[model samples]
Target: MEKAGLAEFNVKIVESCLVPPCLPSPRATLYLSNLDNQPLVRTDSNVLLVYEVCENVLPDPAKTIREALSKVLVYYYPVAGRLRKKEDGKLQVECTGEGVLFVEAMVDKSLSVLGDLDQLKPSFKQLLFRFPSNTAIEDVHPMVIQVNHFACGGFVVAVSFQHMVCDGRGVGQFLKGLGEMARGHVKPSIEPVWYRELLKPKNIPVHDLELTKEKIESTSDSWIPLIYKESTQMSLTLDFETVKYVKDGIMLECLDNCTTFEIVAALVWQARTRVLEIPHTQNVSIFFAVDVRRSFNPPLPNGYYGNGVVAIGAQAIAHDVINQPLSYLVNMIKKTKMSLTNEYLISIIDTDQFLLDIYSNQANIILSDWRWLGFNEVDFGSGSPVNICPIYWNENGPNISNGFVFVHSPKRKCDAFKVIVWMPPQEFNLLEIEIEAITNKYVVNGSNY
Candidate 1:
């Protein structure tokens, strides 16, 4: 097992500039919805899309993407703006049309020499632009992109977007539009919508008087922590057939219809609780983000690229979570997921109590599902990306673990997926053994790895 540290790679910047909308967009202030204004989402998220050289010899990726980004910004103008706190201590976007940061760079090594690009490495951060030292979250750009061209003509489009502006689905929609523009489309297929008022709460509660105030302040810009820890990475792959087989087996004892995410999530939560040796009398929870785009009456508009997902989780005693049958855990997750309705989401937005509970425990495990987020389908003229990966775990706080992200396997495409997790090295080794036990009990049954 290798440590998650910087690799021997260098990226030389060839060009860098701010790209405003190619056409004029409305200049106005957009108030963020209560859901989008969560202090937990006040940070930036990074992603990398690796592409091989196309045979047709298309236009330069950086130029094409830069031009396309400017065009796309005309519709998503809020993304080109800056964020600030209002008189009520809530966040809002000032549509200044100042533009986003774009950079073009050249890497010394070819994509092949980078070993397994699927597993995230700390050095991969170099693929994206580094923020200025001591820059506050509000002071950072809403979006930043770096197109790294390799010696083999392959390239990686590394991007950073503020989580407060977009979730997984929102980012996917934006990238799809960019790809469309690069391919010579005059406009995006689905028009971008920005009716944040539609998602606003009936009555916004004051956070300063609530229990969430402390949690919110901890994430504030001025309270940087002095301690840091080194994290390790691990992954487990489950192919189509094995997943189907496990789902079928679990359904026999669990609900009639269990999703792949539920089954896998259950396995992960149980294995982690067992390996961490958490006290049986204590409680453990698993939190995950669920996209609520279609949960509304008429459904959020086709192109409403905002933070439309809500974080929900299930809690249980450590003993029960680890000792119970796998089907029991699967059913627990399914029930929690099925309980989320439009009314439930609305209540969460209206009150800060729900969010405080979700983050109340530092030992909780957080998961994000990107298997169907549509990142692999984003084509920038050449073709769909060969690999898409989150550069690091940005959502976790100092007390929490690095967490897990479920992504589609680049090599297996539709038939397989990978679960990327981060933890200390010793704990990671025990986690692998626990995961292997689950695979042996459900997927292998005696088959070799």
Candidate 2:
């Protein structure tokens, strides 16, 4: 079912309920680290997983996941608890052993009817459970999950959880736990550890760096409405050969080596800046979330599920970003990544200030590299998800200035890259050309806007 080229499908809710821990869990208050309290993690993050019909399907996928979720919650108990504010204005979880919201639904059509899953559509929002209108974040369930079984025996799992609970790697670990339980395991392979205290700023000296700390403004009061115009979302892909070619090209320019993400992010940041036609002298920033788990001396525990990511930015004048060689921008990102030292990370945590106001910077583009975030490993009894992606809607009236996610190609996930972007329509068009020029090859563009 399709209308005006948007994904259209009727999802009928079969059952909805809250599932608590199958076993008794600790009932206490869990303190959140400063990284968890950052404004970026204050909102709910939603993702959709599409699973194609399999030859040997498990009996009752929804029931299997629901039961597995309960068992998993026993370990990830904090996720089943509600968030609350302490007298000091810091947020913490009051592990009351409540529960997470789960729903079962039936879709009217097969998953294939929605066309290429790589492309995103606003109507994909229908697959998720609607949080109560005007509910405060603290009052809402920490996690929400909806399983939609399609007419063709395929199914889609939509999950929405408070970002403050965990980052991408953390969520991936939690999902793997569910997969383990669904496969008849008594418990998760890796037991969870909540050692947030280890990350708390000790008596270590805090150093101020180029990374700026700014206050985050609410959506309504932010600059989005003042400057935000129409924006669209689309996906593009670069295969293994193309990426290697680009890397070779970069080597010819500079002797420094670059990772695939560093090169692609730099190319995209430059393309976006050129398409925006910003003033030459105006500053432009490329903000990205960096995982600081390895920055610690002993490193966070293997099963530590929390917000371990901190936002950092690379800045340059618009003119330089546009006119400089791709290697120039790549070097900037490389340097920024090199700055993620344990001391720097502690300073950021000690500063007690939010790292970046994402939308406030009009000429900036925020990027996330999800190629190796372990999302591809999330599986249930049937098989691995055919497609997995973050969900973005215009419910808040398009507050994003420019956002991009670098993902694995659905077809060739091992060595290919898929870049998803949301920006003004015209700019997206020019970006395609600029990206082709950067790679010196044609890129496959998704038809869906």
Best by lDDT: 2
- Candidate 1 residue runs with Cα over 4 Å from true position: 1-7, 203-228, 357-362, 393-402, 412-414, 444-449
Clashing pairs in 2: none
- Residue-by-residue lDDT tens digits, candidate 1, 333-431: 988787677666665677743454344444577889987777888898988987777766432321235478888777536678888776666777788
Q: What C-alpha root-mean-square deviation, in Å, does candidate 2 show against the real structure?
A: 4.4
Best by TM-score: 2
Cα miss at 159, model 1 (Å)?
Answer: 1.0
Worst 10 residues of 1 by lDDT: 218-227
Q: What TM-score, computed on C-alpha atoms, does each candidate reach?
A: 0.88, 0.91
Candidate 2, TM-score vs. the true structure? 0.91
